[model samples]
Target: MLVISYDLEVFTPPCSPGALTFSAIARLQGNIAPALPYLNAVLPNAVYNPGAPALVWKDGRRHVVFHADHLAVSNLEDRNAAVEQVERLVRLVNETWQERGQIEPSYAVRQRPTPMMLYKLLPGTNCRECGQATCWNFALKLGAGQVTVADCRPLADPIYADRRAQLLASVIEDQFV
Candidate 1:
């Protein structure tokens, strides 16, 4: 069983043509070029494929990347293993951060904007617990950054594992991860 893994939240922004995310920000500006190789190695299963540039912000740095997608994966199953992998990957990128003379390298510290959250609420059961009437409507709200992930109720349902998974993919973490 795939007991645990990083839970990812994927979403698109309203003003942009592609998606906006937080993870991409950690790659940093000058560090982005060198960091890609490390990210590519760790995220072997997850591909940036057609993901467009995203806006990533931390403390005082705002990374404006034009093409990339934000990915959210499970951090539950085998957290020790997952955290270890992330740590190794971070070390690789931190090397790049050091070359730039940055005092600190921030990783996973900002909230990413994902629009896909609205529909993630959909049990596909069309259960109209939310006034929106449809999950798609909720998704639209989420993409606009108007609706929050907590507003999604069906996510708490045990039967909505898949739905919860989808919801997980559309939220941005609020921490200096």
Candidate 2:
């Protein structure tokens, strides 16, 4: 076991009986995936999007939400123990989240129309190589933090090297920071 420990504070949408959220949180830890057996079994159409654990700052509330595929720990205590469990779970969740998150951009230059810029920088080959008809469309989704730059096979060239780097850096910053 690690010398230091942590706690996470998680806020989920709404639960149905024993249903947990896709993502979870503990105070010391931010993003940990939740275990949802009831929902997974009951709602087959439920989105099993294993979202990245992130430290979200919104409405003056900093929450760490993780997109979970399943929950493993069944020893979460009510109050104090919950705190310790949250912290430990948070650490583990962060490790897992970091392992599966968006690609990082090369530069830290913030831009509002990033998706558009990415689209413009895209090759626009639409050769179905990137699994999309238009690179612009893909860029739009990428900018909205929906898709990754690697999706564009054409852009995966030496010509778009610099731009690709920048785009990846931006993505990583958003998801990890």
Candidate 3:
């Protein structure tokens, strides 16, 4: 296993003091630099930096960073949640390491789409079908990896087919693929 042992540290974000959210770091006993490219290949929407030997990914609403010596996760609910997330990440690393031969490792880096870029492609109808206040808000969430292009219901309309296609091709992760 890539991460058979680790020391966990969980705390509130220093920048967001008193915030309800938590962040955690797992100091691994071994280096995981070699597994990053494999992780980048398997994780859609992941941002990998080969120079830094780090891989950044979004797991649901949480932000996760995998480095050579440690794993960091932020925007968690509580200590228990942080622990669970770290455990899950460790398992993922081990599994990915074991299955590395079956997967193609990728060294290409991907940039997350900007909010403005996503907003321009949105329908801009201010529809509440996505449960957000405005299309701009949805764009912001989409850029942050908190929401998917599919959440914008208006994009499903035939009239917005081209825009939808553009979003899928340019920025949105292809979950179906």
What TM-score against the true fold does each predicted structure earn?
0.40, 0.36, 0.64
Which stretches of model 2 miss by more than 4 angstroms? 1-109, 174-177
Q: Write one digit per residue (lDDT tens) for candidate 3, span 34-83.
A: 99999999998787878767788877767688889988887699999999
The numbered model that scores best in TM-score is: 3
* Candidate structures ordered by lDDT, highest first: 3, 2, 1
lDDT by candidate, in order shown = 0.38, 0.42, 0.81
Residue-level lDDT of model 1, residues 1-177, one tens digit each, is: 111122223223222233222232122223233343333333322222222322221111221121122222222234344344344434444554445443332222223434454454566555666556777777777677666544666655668755554444434332112
Tens-place lDDT digits, model 2, residues 17-69: 34232223332322232322222222222222223322221111111222332
Candidate 1: segments with Cα more than 4 A from true spot: 1-34, 47-89, 92-121, 126-128, 170-177
The Cα error of candidate 1 at residue 26, in Å, is 9.1
* Model 2 residue 90 lDDT score: 46
